[model samples]
Target: MPAESNMSTHSDPQSSETAFLEMRDVVAGYGNTTVLHDINIGVENGQIACLIGPNGSGKSTLMKSIYGFADVKSGTITVNENDITGRSPQENLMAGMSYVLQDASVFPQMTVHENMLMGGYVFDDDSQAARRAEELYDEFPILGDIRNQNAGTLSGGQRRLLELARALMVDPEIMMLDEPSIGLEPRFIEDVFDRIKQLNNLGTTILLVEQNAQKGLSVADRGFVLASGEIKFTGTGTELLNNDEIGRLYLGG
Candidate 1:
């Protein structure tokens, strides 16, 4: 692994104690296959942290491991100082974490409003889900305008927005997004990123895995570089963006 850049902005040795989400010495992967080794990362509360790397660097695996989709061979994962290792996806959702996958995940046959309500299925009262959907629609008026339309009929950008809105129905404390900008036109990418910032500003911490390195780091409060299943660099967004080595090796400078 490359040496971490020396220009990090937050250098406190006790940062882990303050981190809202943390992974310590995690070794994880699919069954019978270990893809991550000794992974340690932390995302501060209410901050946007971006993970970037070349293809096949185990970015998606890390996210899956955190959300309990992948097996963790060893180590601990935590949120708000609560150990959450090996928690189920449903449990994680109930614990205030939401994950938006890299693939298109909308229920094609369902109407936009119905899909949004699905996100709040954990709610015991159906009326609560309905009210939450209305709150989301207010935040995303574009989704509200097409509330009755089938989700499959929406454009790429609109679909992405709906996915985001759906995830917000539960008002999660932290959201994990995998390649949120994928499969969209250049015009929609910026819009999606802007919404991400908006969500962060609204007090949701974010862990983002983005293929677009430069753009991802540009918006991140903190950045991590994962390569060959290990972390190679850790720094503030600006620190990584300006480092000559990172610029050459990862940012296509």
Candidate 2:
């Protein structure tokens, strides 16, 4: 079971409300390569926060740092009020955070059902994990339909769906998605975003890095613009979408 986190009292007074997840002056990198420079971002409880920027802007790196895959040289990362900086990935997961990376992270040789079982690896009880998998299958019926097929044999979109279904096994409070719409067809991309919205409606707070700025912002409550490892803009999704500078710079105006 994951720890029940407490909400932080310290917050930016200018903001309308306190955040559920916050990164304060975060300076993180991999090895000697500094990717995120003094990054500060936050996501409120049950809201979908989207990260958008040009390639190499460190959007993914910021998400990686939150997932504990990158090294934090300074600053702090807090979930609720817990300082989770420098924690291991497993530690973060146990603290009620779930991360889905940009790549196809499924076990290619395993059946879809088996791959989903891997998601609950953190839980000691096998029966509980199995129950969770069944619950996700009900939520994502396509996954249930092809549960016996080998993961590698599925289509690109199906694979992505499996990856998402697997991540839901833990019923995480905060779900960090890295480019969830990356390689799907137009219809499948719509489906993916729809799933994201549905998850948000079900009370999961989301933080995601997306290449499709227009669609990403459309589904998000808040949007962030990162450039060269720094935050350039922060506002409601509609505000950024309507900003001429943001549209010209990132939204393919």
Candidate 3:
């Protein structure tokens, strides 16, 4: 049995001051629609924090708000204690943050190597991008094997792997992945999660939104449950997994 956790309905603002990524009292949405209200969450450095909720629960909106895709009506978002509210996506990427959207993002016409190079477009020197791609290839040898193949020709799993590797070009301090396992085959799902753990082992902090609640919480260091755009439960991953109420309501027990 998993040990119990101090699951709280609301986050403690004072406790999150030192978090690597922190959002406080943030109310965000697209245009005039407010999707999130008084959202408060924190992710520690080198930790895998996951958000799991039902559809339309604003899980994606929360991520979008942090990555500058949604409008923040109030409050602040900080990374490494530096305020980054309202920063553009490009600015966030330059500041050691990378976001992988839920939708398929590979460029069909581009070769695997070319797609990898695109990930490093922010680099001032072309040689630097090449070097980074080589390093990633060493880490993900399968990508190296398919370097010459057009991205459109790759299988679903291959495209997913490419997306993950490409995002590593900058070696981001933190990576935000939304529904990474969605649309993947069972075999590929495990592979994706394994790579996620590997990345964490190599010092990349992760903030994830996954529809597979059990799988997501199983690997997460910390977990948050959002409903109706508000955080309803916060605890260690094991705690959330073991919580009877959580399992009954969210885990379909």
Candidate 4:
């Protein structure tokens, strides 16, 4: 059984020259080799901000660094004007932010509902955790229908959805998703994308790392193009799509 989380406070944000998340002059990577260099990004409140680039472009590395999974050599990561760089994973998780890593993210042996419980494990009250799980199930009915099924046995898309349900267990105001469409069949891809928007519509700011460029931009309110760990371009998703150079260079024009 998992404990209940305190999700009473949602992160209030400012959009005027203010970003809920900002990474400035960031240079980080594995032990000694740096993958991201002088990276800067800003995500405002209630938006789907996406990062897209070729493989090895440090997209995932940047995401991990923001979540405190990668090593940071220089820079700052802030959420809502508060400094949060180098915060431990649990620290970030408890600060109204949650992560749903690519596919293969859930506890394979746990029941669907059990996995939801695990997501809110940090909460101190068991009753609170239980209530949160019930709420998540209602938000995601697929999981509700298969609450007792082993998570490992669900289809690729179903598992991805379940991971999202778990992330909501803590009622996070921010979600960082990494390549969620991986291993999913084409038909359910749209559903996954739609759900991502639904999360944002409900007030969960999203920082997304997606491989499918066109699809990613379609849902993104803002987009960043990363090259060799540096931001090459930043604009509204529509602006990027309409740019002659950006379309030819990145969007399969």
Model 3 C-alpha lDDT per residue in residues 187-224, reported as the tens digit of each score:
99999999999989989999999999999999999899
Please report, in order, the local distance difference test score of every candidate based on alpha carbons: 0.89, 0.85, 0.92, 0.83
Best TM-score goes to which candidate?
A: 3
Model 2 segments beyond 4 Å from truth? 1-17
In model 4, what lDDT does residue 124 have?
Answer: 95
lDDT, candidate 4, equals 0.83
lDDT of 4 by residue, 1-253 (tens): 1111311011212222578788887889989989998887778988899888888999999998988899989988889888888888999999888988875878889899888889989999888899998887778887889999998899888988998888988888789999978778999899999999989988999989888888888899878888777787777676666666677777788
**What would the per-residue lDDT of candidate 2 be over residues 154-244, giving only the tens digit for each residue?**
9878888888778888899999999999988888998888888988888999998999999999888878889899888787777777777
Error of 3 at 33 (Å): 0.2
**What's the lDDT for candidate 3?**
0.92
Highest lDDT: which candidate?
Answer: 3
Can you list the residue pairs that collide in candidate 3?
none
Q: Could you tell me which 10 consecutive residues in candidate 2 have the lowest summed lDDT?
A: 1-10
Work out how many backbone clashes candidate 4 has.
2
Q: Candidates sorted by lDDT, descending order?
A: 3, 1, 2, 4
TM-scores for all predictions: 0.95, 0.93, 0.97, 0.92
Please report the TM-score between candidate 4 and the true structure.
Answer: 0.92
